[model samples]
Target: MSIWWSLHLRREAASVPLARRLLLGTMETAGVDPDVSYDLSVALSEACANAVEHGGDLHSGGASQAYRVTAYLDGEKCRIEVADSGPGFPAPGPGSAVRRGAVPGAAVPAVTAESGRGLCLIEQLADHVQVSNRPGHGVVVCFDKILKWREGALLRVS
Candidate 1:
């Protein structure tokens, strides 16, 4: 029995708490352990913050500026995707200076007092993080975590 949940909301600061509650509830309903729930909540909070801050101008009128969150539990793995309607910036490369504390490409500057770090935390928390621009739209951030499922326990069907 797999559990899944999704939400589409306006990109407002007020929506952060709502997103957090949604994730927490989903995690609890999916049988995630308490410790795992804490970790997931932290990761989800960070992701939502990034979306609200850098995703786009949520104050602008229309649906193009909304934020979306989707989550699902598939056996021992949980997947979450957060997307926002904004012009997406290029994420740092695998070995970029941002990752190595060196310098990025010739056009990009070294890590200074202004930027770098969000992705680092996200990488550490989630088993996997994927970022991409939605075609003709905005940006999407996908996160996945592996849950330790106890053996011999039957999954609840809902």
Candidate 2:
């Protein structure tokens, strides 16, 4: 069986934990290995935290700006995607704090003296990570992790 869930959250600090808790609970109930669950949870928190901190023009709409988190589980793999309606990352350059995650083949920048390390951390934790941005819209961070279930039986999705 496959399980999937999505959340539309206000770009607030509290929403980060709420998303983390739900992901943790879902993974736990699905029998995902504790270590793997913890890793993913931390990664998810980082992703959500990035969203909350830089996901959008939080002060522009006065409450309408938001981000989205989606997750999917099937068999031995779980994938999560975090997207926000922010003004995408700043252009990449010599002194730019943003990055080249826009193109699918864009190499994830090496950890340098830059301020943003969220993407680097996500890449290290998840089995695979992909980030893309929509011009004049926002950015999306998608990642997946390998899962080891406690039981070999078919897992059901509630």
Candidate 3:
């Protein structure tokens, strides 16, 4: 079975949980394992929080105030993407080939740092992660995880 959904949400703190809850509900209904659902939900929350805090230009007065979350469950994998409407990540310097966005093997934030841990946590939870800047637009965080269905899953892939 294949399932997919997308949410266009305002960049607000409350929107984070809303997106997370929707994802959990969808996974629950589709019979995803509770532990797997929980992990993704947490990752989704982090992504949404990032979008809420940094997805807009506070001083620009006209920057978009919305972000997007999209999820896909197909075959044996589930993929989630959170995209924000702020300035994209700065271009990586010549010697920093993979430093633009958070890749799985990239350096993680220091433990005592106050912020910037969301991407690192995402890298840990998802099987594969890719962070990219959309030219002339925002940044996108995309992640995928192999699925493990419950005993009697409704949408289990054979």
Candidate models: Cα lDDT each: 0.70, 0.80, 0.83
Clashing pairs in 2: none
Model 1 regions more than 4 Å off:
90-116, 134-136, 149-158
Least well predicted 10-residue stretch by lDDT in candidate 2: 96-105
Number of colliding residue pairs in model 2: 0
RMSD to the true structure for each prediction, in A, is 4.9, 3.7, 3.1
In model 3, which runs have C-alpha deviations exceeding 4 angstroms?
58-63, 91-108
Candidate 1 has an lDDT of: 0.70
Position 75, candidate 1: lDDT: 75
TM-score of each: 0.76, 0.83, 0.85
Question: Per-residue lDDT for 53-123 in model 3, tens only?
Answer: 87877566554588999999888899999998797655545554342346433444556979978887887
- Provide the global lDDT of candidate 2 against the true structure: 0.80
